[model samples]
Target: MSDSSVSLRPGSTIGILGGGQLGRMLALAGAKLGLKSHIYCPDPQSPAFDVTPFKTVAAYDDEAALRKFAAQVDVVTYEFENVPAATAEILSSLKPLRPGANALAISQDRLAEKGFLASKNIPVAPYRAVHLLEDLKAAVAELGLPAVLKTTRLGYDGKGQRVLRQPGDAEAAFAELKPHPLVLEGFVPFEKEISVVVARGVDGSVRAFDPAENVHRHHILFTSTVPADIAPGIAKHAAMLAKVIVVALDYVGVLGVEFFVLGGERPSLVVNEIAPRVHNSGHWTEAVCLTDQFEQHMRAVAGWPLGDPRRYADVVMQNLIGDEVEVVPGGIDGDTQPHLYGKAEARPGRKMGHINRIVRSE
Candidate 1:
């Protein structure tokens, strides 16, 4: 790791891995801070390239291109968690990869992440690893029916997941999935879902934004509402949990931690997953907070002090998925701010844009 004292000033360049919407937003935020962004992605039509001045269209394993890209940037960060370990290693050897490879490594595998969290005494859903048909059957027996069977790696947006609602469903589900490395999680009968977006500075200081209550449609994030209708104590606990994770990873940059809110006489939170980069759930921070999550991530990766994450107003972020993007330009009111990712084709289940509406102050 580079010395924290060796901060990248405003004119420095940040190299971002993965040229998706998250990268696009980060590039826009960096530009506001007078920091240039160089995007690296295999896709020639990556939307992030539209905003960044410097871009390298190459595969993640292109070491020659990776080295060349690293030499030009002062620091490195990623927009997604699935960044290959080798890619992160090569980049960190040349330029500082803030949040480090460990963060990505842990978050990439479901088993490892759950183990790490459990070791840290952080609550998570009951899970068991599965490798074969017998293992799947045993895991089903232990976790019970109505459990989730998910692949250990590279799964997102409802992919690589199967719900086993009955004992007989396990084998068929496993057959359908053919997941070599899998994890079975006992379902959490939670009333709500929430996420905390937290930033950890190079100095190990952590700052977390308030929890945002999340709503999902077809297993994809539908909306995120800030000033989530939860007890203040429970919100604080969730933020604290995120801070614990950041500190444990020795992370520098922003991370999103998703939680299941169990509503009862005693409100509690259980971690669902850890996103090792700027998250979809945090888009509301763009319109509601003075220092948005994107800028906060840029600041942290550049070795700057952590920014204030407190929101002064209540806001709701609604994603414009697929055809919904077409109506955003005309359907939104004056209070709503529309952000469109410069994606050319709006395929089904693709996130094309989002609109944030400030509802009121806390």
Candidate 2:
């Protein structure tokens, strides 16, 4: 925000505002290019802190800490979309926040993201905003039963959302869900879900990775497979859709654009949602592609030349959830790469690590 014209050179420090797995990976990727990273996070046990010695354990709203962080780093970026708008503003005022505040604003709220995409003539599921019980009832009447009611803000990984199958389910869901504003979306009977990870540079250059088919268990992403059986034309179109959204936002850095495919061999697509940072679905790129999403993101944010995103293998990336962490040690596989996040507690539903298994060199 403060300096879009600024380009960081090697040895520049990039400040990252989240200390999850994504932040940890970003730091590692930056180090490969002679770039240093400073991580700022509230959690003392943040996994990212394990990799980078430069860290500030402070609340995001601590403007004093944020300013001090900005003074040390050349630019700022975040690993997650739920970062507070005020926090983004504080950082942006002092240094350029890659992907900018506009991208964060749209992605943090479901209603805003859907509306922004729809404005560009992109296909999204029919949705309506719900502010009250009566609003939810009216939305159900209009959009019909079997719709999804989700909180407008801070919802991710299947949290803060519910399905209204019966007429009486709406009230229960509304009462259970906190925060007044919500969104009700018509359910699409899609055959498959896919995602394209795209990167936009400060110079207005854009490139996209191949689309990957996604499968979920308990609403958490379980696996992502490259060379999704969708037709070649569909894959091209998915990337084009991602370009439209990224260009419209004037966003810099990496974005994860998800989609829903209907029909069989001849498929029609709908834009599901967009993540303004590196995504779980694109994890396969780390093992298969010469220029993975993590490095691509670093290149974009630091104003370096974007790396080629061509993949060299047919790969399936799988997440190790909770107790599944133990399975990796007893592994037998071909070209399997294990990436474990250094977290001590493997709580249920928590993402402990992931694997990128190369099926064959392509």
Q: Identify the leading candidate in terms of lDDT.
A: 2
Q: State each model's CA lDDT, in order.
A: 0.91, 0.93
TM per prediction: 0.97, 0.98
What shift in Å separates residue 23 of candidate 1 from its native position after superposition? Answer: 0.2
Residue 178 CA error for candidate 1 (Å)? 4.1
Enumerate residue pairs that collide in model 2.
Answer: none
Model 1 residue pairs with clashes: none
Estimate, for each residue in 1-362, the C-alpha lDDT of model 1 and write its tens digit.
45555589889999999899999999999999899999999999999999976999999999999999999899999999988999988988888888788999999999999999999999999999988889989988887889999999989989998999988888887887744778999989999999999999988888998899999998899999988889999998999999999999988899999999997899899999999999999999999788999999999998888788878788899999999999766877768899999999999999999999988534
